[model samples]
Target chain A: MSTAVLAAPFQAVFDANSQEFSLAGVIRPRSVDEIAYSITEFRRAIDEARGVLYINVKRLAQMNNTAFHAFSRVVLDACRTRSDIRFVVVTSSVVGWTERMFHHLGKIEPQITVEVYDSKFYPGQSFVEDTSFIPILRAQTKMTWRHERTILPRHGMRPGIAMADICCGIGDFAVLAQKEFQPARIVALDHSKPSLAYARKVAAEFGVTGIEYTYGDASEMLLEDNQFDFVTCRHSLQVFNQPELLLKELYRIVKPGGRVYITNEKNSHCLGEPRAQSIQWTYNELARLLSHFEMDVELGPKSRRYLADAGFDDILVESFMITNLDGDPQDFADVIAGWEKMFAAMAARHGEAPKFIDRFRQGFRDHIFAALHPKGYAGWPIWAASGRKPL
Target chain B: MNAAQRQPAEAKFEPLLQFEMEMGTFLSDWHHCDQLSNFMARMISHNRTDPVRHSNFFSSALNELLEVSFRGGSPEGRIGCSVFRQGPKERVRLSFPCSPTQRRFFGEAVARTHKGDAYARYLDAISTDLAPSREIVLLDLAINFDAEIRLEEDDPPSISIIVDLPLEGIVS
Candidate 1:
């Protein structure tokens, strides 16, 4: 017989059939005694479970340091001793720091699995994370001609064209295009509220008007068919699980005579060579690390084929190399910091390996000392492909 | 003689207690460094309920060293920490590579502080009100460079920070 109890800070339910235990509530336990009770109760429930010990921490909010440490200790201890039962933590997306704490606990006991349900992609509709402070720093740095040329003026952007920038984080390209081309109407679409908020603030700061920022899934954007004269999604397509579906959406949204363009990092040429040295991990190494953790991001080269398959005529794919050996120290710092944030976020999202955590810590130091070496150099590759919709 | 056999006798300190951890040297990468600070506090306290008199002092000192290293402008770097009670004293030592700018800034910060304050103002620039415990007392901070002791150092030479932690009834 399973029991349900009011564990003060937690309302734990015992699922007898599935052999699972779940905790949810405004988890703000007052004293060490309460924290101990919570852990002990959860442990007792876990000992009873036969199969997967699903400890759903999805609804836990306001967990102080003591509560978190206490609860994580139980989970870690259970993972260490119990072979008959598999311990799983169903985490919430509200707090990223909790993910880090669990990441550390999981590292201590690498056997535990932390399942975070934050996938926001389907067919061609999805959201990509661009919350790192590094992109703002990149925007502060001057734009390169090679990257700009690939997306801009190639499809003959005129003032009268209606443009839509899909998955536009901070709308840097959109803002730039708005200034240079003076497009009649530019609608920037992105799914992340925080990113869109930042993009809006930046656009407003630039005093650049006539560009509308709409928030929604890219696959099912609230846009009418054949409405936009030109559509562009940069540094985002690769992040989509179904790049082809987003392309199809792009094809459907663009006018008959209009064009659609999208680009992503080719893992090999994505960031210049210094990126590897800065982090002390080569592209191959990073790819392996990402795969080992199951991050499922689109870093591999896949845009060209998808664009062609989406039925665009006169498709053009181009590769651009940005060599920044002569860039400022601050620029290098910003770039490295950006990559560091991105890597940590990725690792946190896909359960950090207990062994790799130590190496990852050392890698940062190695990257720093290597970056500061007198002969330091940095560069990376970006791939962009554009095609016109059938008239 | 074989390399191992040829080596002279090495004096080793018998550690009463010891712990090891690694951290990034840059502070601009806030989350990385913040987690590192917490790790230091956790390790120093050994997650024990016993009051660690000068836990904040250790955190503040470590934060200062990390911030000083970041001033050198290297986007990449790491610091290795070894905390142990050796011989008659307990100490936490951090070692990492440093750039010319980092060395200069760190030296300046140390120099600018009043002798009595022990660079508290300089350290305070990066952190504030660490709320150190009453049991903790300021001790000597030693800085060492790998090459400066023997020959001309590399452009960005390696450096080390040794902070003595005087704990009553806890020392060897």
Candidate 2:
């Protein structure tokens, strides 16, 4: 027996014949309190449903920060408790909104499937779709600073200590630091709202407080001078268009004697062969393509130099290697899929000869996977760099 | 001998190692636990004077068991642990508060030990390649509920998992 589920902001109708529950309703909450209340109620209703629950966000309109966080929290909470619920967000041409929602929510629990459709669906109605994205950005959310095994101030999350995490993707480092380091307060700055939202939501999920999520270009971070006791950036250092400027920004914000820590990929040295073997040839070709595309590339060994140029002292750089051979199989698959997605996006922007491109792409993927297999090893070098401002 | 002589000589196990820590719910991430376990294993290997076989064995076992225990409870639940080595035996005691769901999940895992091959395989793996003279390994698990307290109490009942390891290579 199935019963019709009723909740504010959601109306779930159960079909006894098909043994399915469809959730759909207008979710135009007027206030933040309303958003929170409605989301909590929605979760309860969905949880109480007898059959499989399929939520439709297509009818949801007028999404604000309050609404977005509420929606994301409900999905995350559902994922934590049960894996059966399916939440779908439909979009038309502008998929960024839907993508951003899934990007942040999916990071916390990558196992939860979020189905997306491009078709138009009605308000106050529900539908079922089994389609979901590959979740390429899932790995970023799972990144943690605790694994670095480097020497930094692991203590002192007191009320007096201040920390800043520049380009803090989804705020993992900042959150982990705040929880473990006992910092009085921390500011997580990122240019992407979706990433920041996700970070804030995670902070809430972990019950972490005393941290501020700021949305702004990290290179031009508007934090006060000498305002922080610690400043750090992780894998995002390599992605910055102007790393020198970002370093200066890091230097500018740190109080005298405060530390700056960073770890980023050594792109060229990643998964390279010692000789001109077929694997090495594939890596070289990829590098050649990247260079031809005029992408900004950073030298891993020059991290210390960049920090010194930005007016920091006592700089140290150490190399760390990560390989799929020692990692989870699922993560290995994600890495391969991520590479394919990146190449496909690049090809869309920068067209190449179809036949040559397909052959090269296939060869490149095959070589990378073969190297990453358990019998083989594909390792990448990361530079862990740290510096301190003059006292 | 006086009073000491009046009683029979109680068999005492010599202490080889001891460590204790309160791990908060933040360690729900299996990777963090894995890294910590690996680091601890390396530290142990560096400290031990005698040659030891299967150096990473204890760490890997701890990692797997920690994952199992973590999954058995809520992510935000805290765990208090004490690990020690006595004579040729190594023992670990983990205590954590559990919800009803967690309590059931834990009970299921403990019960599955009799019928399933995974738990048996893990026990076998841990027992292989011991130091030299050590004997059998033992696992003791218990879930205790507060009898006198009302259901409204904020503090829930606790579940403890203890594993004892006895292996050969003699020197502590």
Candidate 3:
């Protein structure tokens, strides 16, 4: 059962399925009387819920002491009466005071606990946020930028337009876009604090200004709707379990007639001429390995379908190959070498057979060998897709 | 060198933003507290490490102070708010019209917030059946934010409540 109560600028909802009593919008009522209906609904939710009752205040933007006191009263009463049930107050780090305020309640009542909702939003986040993997991420961006600089213009990227780069890991692309296109505004957002810290350091060291690097979950971004002329999320969807949720946010943030651009890889299609058989075998296993971790490494060709399903129109899709020929062969080899170190560890952690891990390790080594070979051609394919929000 | 001369120079605080309105106009609507804080937070938080998170926290803290001012201040006079920044610390000074009784109330409330057991006292204050005290909000800012709060009563009829919030790296 679900019940909703509106108290002017704020609304409260009790969802039985999630056992969550959620409050959103401004709740700065002068007195407790103003939110009596919400309180009634909240009490009913407490009565209905079993096990853990979640008081979700992630979106309660502005709440006064009166409102807090009222809610705290009900929560304290409930804890005292209902010995069978425990309460978990779900707070958002985005809303800074919520965790602190609720933590006071948790301290007062042992049955009550506080959890920051966005702290564990992405499952694959830990793997990608490893600082050791940062160099490879930079190398990947350096190679991909060569193709994207040309591809972006074809997909409606131009000078003096407002743009957002969602899942902008370490923010290299935002800096590149700032220099090459001079977008009027660029908001580059990522979920990782370490990555954003590194991004800020790099931007400061390079004296690159104007890109607002922010921390955010891509699927549930805090960005305003229809604000960006162009939004780009590159090489990120394949790593997420739910690419569509992220694409939905991208579509919502882009202005009508503005485009949402994305890039993803079909890891199984990674090619090298010198060690074609070994490289192909390892690449195929790499796809399966990523799948075991709930990531879709083969999401590149499916980009068009994802965009179309997300209510986008005038879809455009293209593929590009990043070859050893694109830059110094050493850089290409380094990327593969980095991937080998990262993926081999992941495979081992997943408890893959030692033989299977060895083969997987061999493939990356062969790919690197192909990149460094005097006459060899090594290729990594990426699909670039864009769709316009209907005007 | 004199003892004062031997001390390090105080960090300079850069002016960030300031807003002023007639006390009557501010008190006319309850929503003004929310509107002012949200608007000011958005305006100043664009350059923060996490703009959204910073804005949310700044707005929450500022709204509490605004609410306290709204409820306690006299109806006729000018109300002004000025914000200043020194590194990660942000200073908010709110000046509002106050009678002697209101000033005493605010003064005592702010003084109580400086106590070591203020957090425990705050929990007790809110948990009781008695009417909530204005000090609850101040204690919240003092304990939760580790804010430095002080009162300025040099000017008659109008008093300034200054709070310094070390906000950066604290939100996350």
Per-residue lDDT for A1-391 in model 2, tens only? 0011111244444444443334333233334465455556666656675435445443232133334445555655666677665544333222223333344344456544455443322210111111122143445334223245333543212335778777666667676666556777677775554666676677778887666676445554434457777787776555544678678878877878888887766565655232225545545555555544443334567788888888888887877665555456456456655665565445544676776567546644664566555566665567778888999
- DockQ of each two-chain model: 0.01, 0.02, 0.39
DockQ-based class of model 1: incorrect
lDDT score, candidate 2: 0.50
Off by over 4 Å in 2: A1-146, A149-160, A272-278, A292-294, B1-172
Better of 1 and 3 by DockQ: 3
Least accurate stretch of 10 residues (summed lDDT) in model 1 chain B? B143-152
Could you give the C-alpha RMSD of every candidate to the true structure, in order shown?
A: 23.9, 20.8, 4.6
TM-score of 1: 0.44
Q: Choose the strongest candidate by DockQ.
A: 3
Who wins the lDDT comparison?
3
Write candidate 1's Cα lDDT for A74-160 as tens digits.
665676678677777776443333443354445455567787644444422221354555373344324343356435677656777
Model 3 chain A: worst 10 consecutive residues (lDDT sum): A1-10
TM-score computed on alpha carbons, candidate 2: 0.43
| CA deviation > 4 Å runs, candidate 1 | A1-127, A130-146, A149-151, A270-282, A289-300, A326-329, A358-374, B1-172
**CAPRI quality level assigned to candidate 3 from its DockQ score:** acceptable
* DockQ (0 to 1) for model 1: 0.01
